[model samples]
Target chain A: MTIKDIVYIALFVALTAALGLMPPIAFAGGALPPITAQSLGVMLAGSVLGAKRGGYALLLFVALVAMGFPLLSGGRGGFGVLLGTSGGFILAWPICAAVIGHLVHKNANANIWVTGGMIAFGGILVMYTLGIPWMAVVGKLGLDKSLAIMVAYIPGDLVKVVLATVIARGLRRAYPNI
Target chain B: MLDLYTPGTSMLHRMSPGPKMAALAIAATALFLQESLLVTALAVVAILALYRVANIPMKTALAQIRPLMWIFVIFFAVQWYFSGLTLAAYVVLRLAALILLASLVTLTTRASDMIDSMTRALRLFKPIGVNPDKVSLAISLALRFIPVLGRIATEVREAQKTRGLERSIIAVAMPLAIRAIKMADDVSDAIESRGYRS
Candidate 1:
């Protein structure tokens, strides 16, 4: 990879963590992982950077988290956090970004709304695919129970899908070369 | 806190990146495998001693562990209710020891050195078409920019507050993303100017 690739990856890793700094909206009384904005970073990375760099960017962010930076939402990190309830969401970020990026790339010539739908498919559907089950296994709940907890975040995720689709479309329009 | 890599001459600062990383992995595995209070306390003490041998400041060490304390509280409270205080202590100690081990390694190792070592290890995957150098570079850059983006977020949030948009995730996300992409473009130009191509 060239320096440009490295920079793009770094920027998004930082973007993901930066998004985490904003306080999360608690879905309930904190039983489920609070809705954090880093998922927006995942969406933007995919919708903008496409599959390779987009996925690498989030994987890079996960590397830092693994390195013990408190970069996660709520400033949590380290190996221990890997065993926590939110670990599934954190680990799934790269895959989610990659899936989103892959689908968005397939529809690159399509209008923004179609690209937006792809983002939701990858970001929401694909993420929950791995995340909800991992939450069940790691958190030691029934799959049914985990799905029940995960249900709380659907509305917030839709909001992210809309926001990311808009920003991504606008970003590309203004800076076509990117 | 895994902040910027501070240059230092402490033993930790002097240690080789590879062994330190191995130690972190081993320590973490050991912590999880064993569940006794004796093992947990011993492990914690051993890590604290390693910190001293590495000459990390008490403040830096505590800062690394501080944010995690809240989660521990919840873990402790919940575990205490279910399994009694002894088991809870064992669990929390095991958890704390793992965090400290990760932080200690991170603090001691230089970012470039760690990346170089990782790149060397990742070379094993080259036959499968994975570019280790590129992966390591990405990880290095990500670590470098965590603080930069953080400052940008704070600045944007302040600006949003002025416009009464602070409460809006869209307001924060839109500008933050636009600015990040702009920064990425400028960086790409910088790289291109330096004769690097994707």
Candidate 2:
């Protein structure tokens, strides 16, 4: 990796953590697990930074969270969250970004629509695959119940995928190297 | 924002980052292996004792574990219903112990020092053609970037709210992401002009 790569990875990690500091998109007064916008940053990382760098960026973000930085959604952090209901999704984020990047960027012929589709699949499908199971095991909800709760997260993520696609397209157009 | 590491002269604070981290890793895993609440309760007591020895104030200690209180309550209630009270006690105690241990490490060690340890550990991967220096640089960069981007994103969110577009994911997300990329480009250009090559 060059100095440029280092800069990009750090920038994306900061971007993701920054998004976490913003208020949650869904305003439910902190009762339910309302939708957070940080996942948008994860999608943008993969879509804009590509797989390897994007994955590294998220790995850094997660590492900081594990280190007790209040960088997660709602400004929550520390190792306890790894055992919390959200731990699975938190752990899955790096993989989700990598999958999104790999699927969308691997093929030279892949178009905007293809990228959008892959982001949805990778960010939503793959994330929940790891997340729901972990939620069930840690939160002690059965797999079926975890799925039911996770469904609420889909619409927000789909919107994020569209947002990521537009930004990624614009970024690639302006700075093709990304 | 929760800058946890308090300046102190206690043994924990004086200990090298590597050994403290190793002990934390061991204690964290051990809390999981044993299902007995008795063991976990004892472990929590030992951890609190260490905290006292470390000069971490009770207020600071409570702040560290405070956010977890509600989650612990909910999980305990769930465990009580689905499993049993004994299991619930064990689960909560184990989680508390692990979280305290992790927070203890964070409070004692500096972030830069942790990054140094990370770089040192990654140096073992040099034979695989990976650049540990670059990886370490990236790690440090990520740590520095968190506050910068957080400020930018919050500003964007407020700006979007004025236009009543805050609820629309694209309205807030687009500007935030676009500005982040723009910032990245400027930084990349600065790095290039400084002649930093792989």
Who wins the lDDT comparison? Answer: 2
Cα lDDT, all candidates: 0.76, 0.78
- What is candidate 1's lDDT per residue for A1-178, written digit by digit as tens? 6677678888888778877887888766876556788798899998888898899888878876765566787676654566455577778889989998898877778887898889999888888888888766543344876687678888889999999898888777777756
Question: Model 2, A40: alpha-carbon shift in Å?
Answer: 2.0
What is the alpha-carbon lDDT for the whole of candidate 2? Answer: 0.78
Clashing residue pairs in candidate 1, if any? B1-B64
What TM-score does structure 2 among the candidates reach?
0.88
* Fnat for candidate 1 (0 to 1): 0.59
Candidate 1 local Cα displacement, residue A7, angstroms: 3.5
* DockQ-based class of model 2: medium
Quote the lDDT for A30 in model 1.
Answer: 71
Clashing pairs in 2: none
Best by TM-score: 2
